[model samples]
Target: MLTALKEETYKFCHEKIALLGLLVLLVTTLYSTLTKTINKSTLIFAFGAIEWIPVIIIAVGAAFFEMEYDNKTIVMLLYKNSSKLKIYLAKFLVVFCYSIALALGAILLTFLLSLLTVPGQYHWLAYYQGHTILTNLLLNLFGAVIYCFFIVGLSFMLIMLVKANTVVICIGLVLAYFGASFSTALMHTFPTAVGILKWNPLNMIFISQQLTRGSFALKSNLTNFQLIIATVVYGIIFGLLGYYLFKRRRV
Candidate 1:
């Protein structure tokens, strides 16, 4: 497992897209910070830079698998690492680490931007959305991490099923952008079944909002704990399905 992990990490580090993704995150965050007028630094600090995270996660995850197939290196990988489970897990771990790194990078960049642009406008201890600014930021980062897992799992499954990176990315982007709204529409459209529908994976996308907005629970019909659990469960399910397909696929 450790050897597989090291090999996966080495491959990811050598991917040009990996570095490009990081650069894009920093540049977008910087642009967003500079363009927005300073009102509440806490809001800017927490969300200003993370708007593109999901998009990047989807693209990166899909591209990782796509590259292997495109380069016809998956057969070599399978031959080298006798354990399919280790290869799948190592790839997932690398992507998860990339997601966390992106989240941390966004947070760090946003923090520095906030300090530089409006040093005294907000206090870290100041309460916002029923928690201190620092707490909200931490929770937001946590929510982002959870969402990353969900996306990676779903992306892997889609890639295995469709064998197309573009399709996976498109579906992921649509879900990332419209999933919450779609859930809301579902709740209203089928008011009688909300109790069941509210637990759907689409609804889990609102985990970030529920974490930061005190009133979001009422709107999402799910507590933060429930959303977190549901999201992780869905991630695991998708990941397992993807692995099953991968194991059965002809190399």
Candidate 2:
């Protein structure tokens, strides 16, 4: 499993598509640091926007296997000695690790570039984040990564159901874009939609930042415990469904 995982990790890391996502994050980080404000949370959110990079990039990685159904070549690989469970596990592990490494790498690079822009703004990176820039970045990197995997899982679930990554991505974007609009409508109003819609994975980054900055973390219309359980259950179900689909594929 170790050797297989290493090879799978290499496969994911080698993808140029993932590389572009990393580049985009680095660029966004540099851009984010230009703001004049210098609060702890501001420093956090500046680089934090980069967290969303995986939300986009991981979708591309998830597509690697499902999108291959169209190629016929990926189907050929399925006929070989590997078990479907192994393939699915290998891909999932690779994507998961790649997200962490990618996020960490970008965070470090962003931190370095950030010194020039934000310049001594991350005291909170030390206070709230365990007293070191690297440590804080690592923690956020991992948290953002789990969020990324959950997003990837969601992506695959959509693909398995719809049979097209493009369809999944499109639907996701529509849901996200309009969801933001809906959240804005509710932000000031005291209606039912007021406390919800912001916790959505699509808009989670912005909400996560709001939480970090001491603003309201996306008010859970469902309450905290309910949301946590729902998220966990959601992850487990999709992971099993994705693995089951991989196992049952006729290829």
Supply the global lDDT for candidate 1: 0.82
Tens digits of per-residue lDDT for model 1, 1-251: 99999998999999987997898788777777667676554353454544467678878887897789899999899888789999989989999889899888877876787788788888878887678887888788788788889888888888888889888878877887798899999998999999998988888778765787867787689888888999999999999998998888776
Candidate 1 Cα RMSD after full superposition onto the native fold (Å): 1.6
- Clash count, one per candidate: 0, 0
Cand. 1 TM to true fold: 0.94
On lDDT, the leading prediction is 1
lDDT assessment of candidate 2: 0.57
Per-residue lDDT, model 1, residue 119, is 87
Clashing pairs in 2: none
Per residue, candidate 2 scores C-alpha lDDT tens digits across 1-251 of: 56556656676667665676667676666666664454554445436554455556446655666645765756555665366667667777766666666676766666675676657755533666333544544545544565565666676667667777678767655644564455555554646555455445444433332323233343434433444444555556677887777666665
